[model samples]
Target: MPVDAPMPGSYGVRIPPWLAAEQATLPARITDRTERMRMVNRIAARNVEEGTGGPFAALVLDSDTGDVVSAGVNLVLSANVASAHAEVVALSLAQTRVGDWNLGTDPARPRALVGNAQPCVMCLGTLIWSGVKALDFSVPGFEVERITGFDEGPVPADWREQLEKRGIAVDTGLLQEECSTVLEDFRSRVAAGTITLYNGG
Candidate 1:
């Protein structure tokens, strides 16, 4: 038998062309912190009950205006590809909308990222490369591994320190109980063998 099978079909993320235009016209900032956090959390929660990618969601926001530019959920298992991660999808869409891919730069008003769980290494690297100055997450990485039974890969003990060094500010522990519930649901599904986390075995 062949060692590997061909990918069944195309899998990726794409936002409509009009989205970028829409984002450009958004008001230049949101003053309400609670409103902004709630928006991110609500979107994150939506994907948990019924959406793509396990139980994670992510968003890219305009740091100055607090307007949401792009958002998506983890699509690895659903898309049968590793790049379909929530952060990957969201960042890509945000860049696509802006067309510069440098939205994360600009010391005056860099972009911001929010995710339901701490980003995996691939996403972390993307965040650094993408130039986002601020990151907010609801769940810690260790908790994901402890509760979900999947190896989180080689994230250093000083992950936060590394980000801080790069001028990326991180906020943790928002909506803890709600985010953990999503993690619990993911573990339950994995335990029942309802989904194979990945194809490589």
Candidate 2:
């Protein structure tokens, strides 16, 4: 749902091993990063259009030894509702090179469903369908289930059952107040570091 902060260098927290291995081929590059990412993005979108419903992130392999060069998450938003914004952004990045990109990961509740809800159910559902695992800090009003902890680990009973029934889980106590700022900083760090991929413009 709402992608949360996972251990920065840990590769297995949110992203699956198979996918990561697949993406490892593309070396992180700056020269044509944006354009290449966009091309891969179109492919992911096509997957969604074909009823795959993928906000799928693709890794651009080096084409020779299969080293991961870059990755990009696609299909930022589906329903056009303001509530789904964060999930879209997170998915966008996660599908890219920043493997475990956290989308806030903090426990949150929206005052109204209008333009504030984090990890909207629909958007989350789309992510789950794409086979991506996300760590949410807290999930409230959850009659179905609940999750616990900020890192990847065991979850609550209710949540386990819910996941068994429906392909999703929500954790509690993973909430943090500085999620947005941290997310911004993380992005800035990546963008700054990869300026060459964006052509150092």
Candidate 3:
């Protein structure tokens, strides 16, 4: 059991390596952004099938080496920890595995992160310091509220500009509607009372 951080009080959340190993091998060895996003959707779809609720999922990887550093899915329902968003889980494992927060210029791996949705407020906040190199995501933050009825809170209107300003290459709309379908699935199931949200409510 590894906590995401060594800070006091909250002690962060548990990061089991088994989960990391299971998701480490991404769907393929392709470098195209859209293909990468479709792979992320696969992880998300599995979450739905396994009854993990709104299992938003993410993968942390190294661009230069094309290695899946780690992968994460929402664990709030299973772990009873509200901090277990997919981006955070993936980012946390990534930071630990790389042994440093800043990894872009590293002599090896040259890390990055990819996710199925625009980062929620908390995950967006974590990225500036997570220090992978590039940020790639599938959906727009606005659609998160519109299509899924999930209120993504307080994302600074200029958040992307801010990340770019920090030298973090941020790419959005990777798979566009394809990625949205996963959210739509969750939304439909939630409406039917077949799926529940640990945090999305």
Every model's TM-score = 0.79, 0.27, 0.83
TM-score of predicted structure 2: 0.27
For candidate 1, write residues 50-118 as lDDT tens digits.
534566677788776787777666667655667777788788888887897777556777788888788
Query: Count of backbone clashes for each model?
Result: 5, 26, 0
Candidate 3 residue spans exceeding 4 A from truth: 1-29, 101-109
For residue 64, give model 3's deviation from the true position in Å. Answer: 2.7
lDDT of 2: 0.32
Clashing pairs in 3: none
The digit string of per-residue lDDT tens for model 3 on 104-201 reads 65646556789888888888878777777788888887887787787677889999899889877888887777788888888888789887754551
- What TM-score does prediction 3 earn? 0.83
Q: Write the per-residue lDDT of candidate 2 for residues 111-184, one digit (tens) a residue.
A: 00001112335444434443333223322323112211112123343544554364334333222223222323
> How many pairs of residues in model 2 come into backbone collision?
26
If the candidates were sorted by their TM-score against the true structure, best first, what order would they fall in? 3, 1, 2
Tell me the lDDT of candidate 1: 0.70
The stretch of ten residues in a row with the least summed lDDT in candidate 2 is 109-118
Off by over 4 Å in 2: 1-84, 96-118, 139-160, 164-169, 176-201
Sort the candidates on lDDT, descending order: 3, 1, 2
List runs of model 1 lying over 4 Å from the truth.
1-11, 14-31, 199-201
- Candidate that would win on TM-score: 3
